[model samples]
Target: MAKRGAAQQLQTEVKTDEELEKFLARPGLLILEVYSEWCGPCLGVLGTLRRIKLEIGGENLHLAICRADTITALKRFYKRSEPTWLFATGGKAVSIFYGSDAPKLVAVIIRELEKTLQNASRPTYQIGDLQPIEAEVLRIKTEAIKKAERIEHEKQEKKRIDYLNRCTDVIMENLPDIGVTVFGPQVSRDMFKKLSEPAEHLKMQCKDRKYLEVFAKDFEIINYSCKNPLSDDVIDQLDGKELLVCFWKIDEASGPITHVLSTYAHELTKERVAPPDDEINVPHPIAPIISPIKVKFEVEIEDGEVWVEEISSEEEARKLAERKAAEKSKSATHLQDESRPKDQEGAEDDDEEEASEEEEAMQAVQPAFPNMALDIDLGLDDNIVSEEEMVEEEEEPPKPLTRIKRVKIPPIWVANNRRTHAALIYVFFRSQTSGFLPPDPPPEPPHVVMAFEAFKRDDVMEVVEASKEDVPQYGFFTNDTPGEAKLITNSIYKYDKLEEPSSSDRIVLKVNKVQSYTMLSLVQFEPTYCSNNVTSGRMDALKFFPEDYKTDEEIPPDAQKKQKKKKKTQDASGVDESPKLSTETAKSIDIAAGDENTEDSPKALEGEAQTPEVQAGETLITESPTVADPSAVPTEGAPAAGDGTDTQEPPKEEINADLIEAPAVDGAAAATPAAPTDPAPME
Candidate 1:
């Protein structure tokens, strides 16, 4: 079967059943396709079969189709139903596929051949009742169809060429001034005929404008020199006039065409009409550049100080240098005096010893530093102090600090972290005339906030004024936890006034993040304090910790005593409870807690513990819990009156909810009796 496939290529042999059988007799495949002459589908399939024949022209496979009307001829194989195909191995039909789909037939033949050819030897069949005349007629019909296809392809090729010529003609019409300066590699005269023909306008310019002509490097044009690529005299003639130029080709891998083009454009622009040794000052107009020039234009590299004004005269340049020298001299003198050695021994001492002495002096009395620095205890072992000495120290051994490395923290990092936490810090304009205020922080972990996105707070003014602002904002914060959300101002000068004499309700305006802030409010002062009257009405102005805080465990025993005395006097005086001045108290709490604990811990009684707010006419009535140690007998401050009578109300009534509430803090509920475990007992 393989030999037949190879032999068929060398001769125009018609396939007979006997030949197919002989081909299949070997260890190969037989594909018998059965069809009728009257079937239109069979004709279509024959075309595909010829295509397949071309594709697999060298394969060990036989394809044959029998007319169903001639049943006796196909009896040994398979009968045709419409068009049918049989895959045979070793003279026995392995599989039969019936279809008009040429692709399906081809697939089945290939699949069957793949399955059977590996295991069975090819089989031989007899070519019965087939005449040479009928085979010749089929071959003639196939050749006629191929001839028709060739005619159709040639027609398409002619149309495509006509369309391309039309496009090229249009391109050539607009390119009259284009100068074809061919360099390197000559095309034959026949190929040169294909070059863009010079139009009438270009032909006229040949006499005066010197239109380009191509010539071999060894041969010059009718009058031009080849050795000198660009003649100064030629360039002078082209000045102040537009000229189209082209390099026939360029090899960037070598040569200096780039450098040459740069020098050409520069010298042409300056109208440098003289050789280096000669003097000529010919002024020329800057001419319009015509297409197409082949030169890479890139920004020139310049020295850092290139932008400094160039002194026009030598005298002026020297004066500027002298001024700079004087400035440097003053700086050098100051630096030298400050850094100079006081003594030989002082200079000999290591920086460590000097640093230690400076540190001791700093401890004794701190010097004013411009920048805030964190004091870190770096316990570098000198080996002089034994491990025993570390153990002898009462406190836990300090963690080793290698060096005080200052790290720059970007504001964006903080803003992004806050955004992820669903909290934002941005300026919000209260009214058109007023400045913006810092937004209330988010009530979640700072690290959870997403990136900052800007938005206008006033855009949702109706929502804001309706007392639904916080809920929606919180929802936005929670929902947009992974993205930065910003609110910017809607208009200029429509925000809250920062230094205004009159106190008014802040207007709805944009509360945008810093990065998105384009309109800046020039606040007279930063960190403007909120008045008591405004805070009571606008609760949104108040900032609170994200998580609930547990009250402090205990005030120092002495501090507690001080609070009681103050409270007694307030109650005796019968004064109305004013807003708490808890700045000092908050500071003290922060100090005792080592900055980690952010609880709303009341200050130890100076007998008059203040609330956190500095607002006027606001009151905080601290109540003693039942669980509080009686021996501690802690006093809760009372509201004082003019008559010096204690008029303070008892703590708010406790409800059942208090008993079932989750612990306020993570670690401590039972341990701290000073922190009220329950709400104040009912009056």
Candidate 2:
């Protein structure tokens, strides 16, 4: 077994806004490294950090690492690949830098340490709003996470299939009398006395811990209360094998609320149908409830038995279990008596002794090759040896066998009447659970070797569909849900903005949502142009499900045209204002900053107040913060959403590398904590 280490390597772990505030409240200068899980920290700067710590000592400085993706205060800094260094004295950031340049890193550390020691600090501070991470680093090693999720999904599917399969077998095994529920034409007397409450037996037995344990193993059933959100129609549709696969996804997303609890808990009027009958422990009623029940008893033939012979569902289930166990026991005993004194019996007797030798040998030699034999099977002359081989360069990922083709098709949602004039920007493959289902008895799209194509919904440009077999891909370029897409165009916007607002309307586009099954278009948005927000955002294709790839490394022609269009947006310092985005990014943007009252065009972005300086298929999130009320904020305060007061954040500023390289120490870089944080962490 591998040796286990400490639970966390960081000297201080700040997981929340409150946690970070607490860390900042402590004395001394704190060096907080803005961190990301996707990329790695710079290992080369560790030795310099160690020497700086030895010289400066502990009380004058501190160090820490934080995940921008999780910690709310650092969220906007999510996904950065380059190392971001933030120097904080007290609660405010004193300086910031990017990249792991050793000289600059050391200088910043020592400079801040000395200032803290002398109590000579500046009056003003920079609220460090960190840079957004690059897309490529966000992808590295993530395949392992996706693979793990896919494996877990498969395990659940297997459980469901095993359950449903057994249900079918049980009904078949008890041919003529699986148990009858109806009063047939031949009988005035019913074997089962009708109870006013039908299915009460199931209601009672389902909750019984013992019964639940047994039933749960087969049906994938959990928390099956009377409050389950199964409508009559949903029940009728569940006759197919895909019921479990679809609902909990009913095909993975129940409108982004994947679980039943998330989808219906808000509507539920009661915490539980069978709430405890106590005055103080009262259950509060919410606004909504699960579908009303008007269950009609249906008579179906199970092995030609339209009548249930058993007195109760529980008693019947009990009998079935007992009968199965008895038969299995009898069979085992019979087999044991018949096979007495055989070689198998003697081998079974020696199992413990043989196993002991095997256990002892396992420590020294574990035979784990896929097709290799055990110790018993090894030849007399076989030898186990360890060989040291020269390390080879890592192999590059396999190139996509398919090309992204550009074709013209009228938009899938917006401007349907318009002829084909959009370009496909991206195509992703997702499992059915992601909530986008293909046609019932879906027509085969002639399987190709792993391939992808792109499309974007725009006023004018041509696009083509990239098809795959099982998964559904979502394009988050639109500002509305599936039903609200048509409500976007002036001629096309169908819903009233004041009366019926889209759930994701105006929200910063961080995630992708698929509304259309086909097409793409791209072009310049006229004053009347209704298109996806390309500024303040960029594309990111986070592929979900196993072997479902969204590899579009080569840029299509339309992308080049748009890239040229955004060229004038460059910074005055001659630095390229536009980010070097990876081709695979889905290019997301939040156009929600627009005012709703400003438009009657019906277009989703018609009221967009800001044209955004960063114009392209992507948005530069670092450029601006959405300020709800400027009057309420302090003169130097950063802008924030919702609240009148801006949420204080670290500023986005960089300390240039000053060429202050320290002499290198030869030992392997160790975990050396400075102040309270690990300034230079090994990747």
lDDT values for all models: 0.36, 0.38
Clashes of each: 59, 69
Report the C-alpha lDDT of model 1 over 255-276, residue by residue, as the tens digit: 3333333333333224223334
- The number of the candidate with the highest lDDT is 2
TM-score, candidate 2, is: 0.23
TM-score of each prediction: 0.15, 0.23
State the weakest 10-residue window (summed lDDT) of model 1. Answer: 420-429
Given candidate 1, what's the lDDT at residue 179? Answer: 21
